[model samples]
Target: MGASQTQLRETLDRLGLTVPLADALWVLDPAQPAPSMKTLAGQLHCDPSSATFLVTRLELQGLTERVPDPADRRSKTVELTDKGALVRGELIEAMVAQSPLAALGPEDQAAALQLLRRALAQAERP
Candidate 1:
C-alpha cells in the first residue's frame, strides 16, 4: 500500500520534530504571523499543555516564537522565525522532491496530477 501515518511520522521525526503533524501545520500556515496556542491545540486535537510542550521544543530549535496575542493579551501566539521559515521551506521542498512522479517528464507529471486529483475526489465522497 501507500505510506501509512506511522511512516509519515517517522519521516517527520527524522526531519527533527517530535510532533510532525503540528509542526507541518504551522509551517503551512506561515502567513498567520503568530497563531494562538489554543487555536493550534484545537487544530491538532490535543490539550493546551501538549501544544505548549511542542511549541517549547520548536522554540528551543529557533524555529518558532511565542508572543503575546494582540487581540487577547492573556493568550499567546506562535509564529515561525526566519530560521523556521527556511527549515519549513526545505522540509516542504524535500517532501515534494520525493513524490513518485518527480522523475516523470512534464506531460506525465500533469497526467499523474490529474489521476491523483480524481482519486482524491473519489475518496472525499461519502
Candidate 2:
C-alpha cells in the first residue's frame, strides 16, 4: 500500500479530498459501467450495510450517486459524477507517477519486486 499512500498524499493535498473518499477510489472506475450496491459490497469485501454507508458518504460529497440499475429497476447502481471522474483520473495519474518504483526501469523494477517479495515472505514467518 506504499504506492497508494504516496498517491493519496498528493491527491489529497491537491483536491482537498477526505482520506476515506480517496481510498474508495481504488475500486471506483469511470470507464466501467455503474455497479450495483451488491457488486460494490463484493469489491470492497464488506457487508451490504457498510457498502451502502460508503456509497452514501461519497454521494454526500458529490463524488458518486445512486442511479436506477438498467437491468433491475428496483435496484440501484453507483456511478461517478463528472467531478468524481476528474478526481479519479487525477488519483490514478498520481498513483502511477508517484509510485515508489517510478524512477526504476522495467528490469530494475522486476528485480526489486522479486527481492521485496522474498523479504515479505521471510517477514511473514511466525
Top-TM-score candidate index: 2
lDDT of 1 at 41: 82
Please, what are the lDDT tens digits per residue for candidate 2 over residues 49-115?
9889888888887888999999999999999988888878887788778787889999999999999
What TM-score do all the candidates reach, one by one?
Answer: 0.67, 0.75
Model 1 earns a TM-score of 0.67
Q: How many residue pairs clash per model?
A: 0, 0
Residue 117 alpha-carbon offset, candidate 2, angstroms? 13
Candidate 1 per-residue C-alpha lDDT over 1-126 given as tens digits, one digit per residue, 9 for 90 to 100: 144334445556765765454354444468656669888887777798888888888888888888899999898888887887877776666556665666799999999999989999999999
Residue 29 lDDT in model 1? 69
Q: How does model 2 score by TM-score?
A: 0.75
